[model samples]
Target: MSSIKAIVDQKLILEKMEGKGGWTFARVPKTTANTGKSYGWKNLKGTVDGFKVECSLMPLNKEYWFMPVKAEIRKMVGKQAGDYIQVLLYAEIQELHTPEDFLLCLQDDPQAFEHYRKLPDDEKQKYIDWIFATVDEELQVQRMADAIDRLSRNEKLPKKVLSAGKPA
Candidate 1:
């Protein structure tokens, strides 16, 4: 994947969306986009404030793009809006493999699969990551089952919960 590194010496502006206010982002300059086209820009993997991240750049007018400076990142770097920052970004690979057991469970439960399929990519990644965090096969199976139950009911998984088998 294509990558870029640059210092962000601009202030982070707060923008409003859907009645909620949020921090604005530094933009991906056109020069960055040119390198990313061969790799696709829908999602990028990189670091901000030295923390690893995978995010999609928000497309702007005239082929320009931007990425939000999330609060978690702000806290990690110990800097707020208006602070100069550094960023390193590369196009994230498009191929994401879902576990076979999880896929089978989803196939057997159409309602759960429907809800799972409708989730935003990041949310889906959360569930997938949680389920795979451990190496225990039995635990992974149990987690997949629990995930199916939650999705079937259109319930969001609690952040603190790992699975029916164990605590995070």
Candidate 2:
């Protein structure tokens, strides 16, 4: 079995995906300038989690800039482009969180608690981590639970609990 290699950094991965629109690696034959003879090959590379990757597209799209492949090849492993053609790099996956998990971390302030409940999963975790790092542990736990309870009751946190503090 072949294993892929990658570097894992949340921020960096996001940045690369944003810049490239997706990830892809390619290999092409090199030609001699004078005789037009094939001199071997050259590879184009990209990454995810710091690992090099190659993928095949489900169907061929010749006009598209990127093509999909059967399997992804990282820097550590090598694969011929024609071996299993049709590769295209797609968008990166983002992490999601559940309401229960979100609630468990919002105990610091009921209003901030409600504010957190309304946020998207990614934003909620970012905020939760920020709050957890700065507030007292006990308060963090309490706020998380309180936020959950408020949701269950279909009620919002009081205005006092929503005040902002120094950055975490």
Candidate 3:
């Protein structure tokens, strides 16, 4: 139930329930610096700490809308083109809530108004959350079903392999 403080005016705040199991956000992979050698060695590393949930503002009809956006979930790992990643929804404000109502109030006369305007549009579409199911206790039930299917197929999998990996 930990919540991050965000500006209600300049950004939109949204939440997705981690349910009883909780969740982790992932970081996008970064390109490596050139070594200036003929051997082209590209670095490919995955980061667990890079994932985060953020609120962003999007311009709509001369106004702005706040939406919750998720970044860096493990489900997106090794995703290829045309592949789909699953996301789970938590919660959001149905109506506009002003900055004054934010738990962490906007700083007193916080920076120039233009600063807010210069902010980037990183908000995700509203419907994206509709596609993902919550990462809940039910995941164990689903895993058990998958394991049973694998076992029936005569695949020699180690016991509890499905639950060994990270949870989204």
Candidate 4:
């Protein structure tokens, strides 16, 4: 089930924090986003200065919220840390769906399929989204292959892929 929350629009500076894994994001002031993270992490989909964005609004100390700006999005938008941007966003509870191709790959490897089935929804969603995100078909295939290998071994997903890209 999915539900859309209130919409928000605000100008935010893209800032970076040093200690906490060097996160780069824009703060969504509680004043602006009065409803995004009241329950927990809320998945958001909207636009940042006209560029499409789908992200999670993470709550901090229940005071404010921060939305991470991924490096890929930064490059596409040609914005760097400290740049001000107009953010138009709305939070939603998303329902995760397994991709057919990804499912086919897993079905071939019973152990991997079993592990994937037992994974938390977020973990499963990560793999599904990452595998489908790349426009390059070869990269997508490789991601699926790597995922199955890691899953069958009962290992944490490849850190590189988990973060942004496949490890070189």
Clashes counted in candidate 1 amount to 0
Spell out the clash pairs found in candidate 3: 12-66, 16-90, 17-90, 25-51, 26-51, 26-72, 87-132
Ranking by TM-score: 4, 1, 2, 3
Q: Which ranges in model 2 have alpha carbons more than 4 Å from their true place?
A: 1-85, 88-114, 134-168
Residue 17 error, candidate 3, Å:
30
Can you write out model 3's per-residue Cα lDDT over 9-45, one digit (the tens) per residue?
Answer: 1111223436764322221111111111222222222
Over 4 Å off, model 4: 1-91
Better of 2 and 4 by TM-score: 4
lDDT of each: 0.67, 0.38, 0.27, 0.81
lDDT of model 1, residue 42: 51
- Can you give the TM-score per candidate against the true fold? 0.47, 0.27, 0.16, 0.49
TM-score of 1: 0.47
Quote the positional error of residue 46 for candidate 1 in Å: 11
Residue 119's lDDT within candidate 1 is 86
Instruction: Give residue 163's error in model 3 in angstroms.
Output: 53
Compared with the true structure, what per-residue lDDT tens digits does model 2 show for residues 1-168? 222222121221111123534534332111111111122221223443335454322211322122332234333334432232222223333454444545444544566566555665544554455445545766666666655555455554444455552221
Best by lDDT: 4
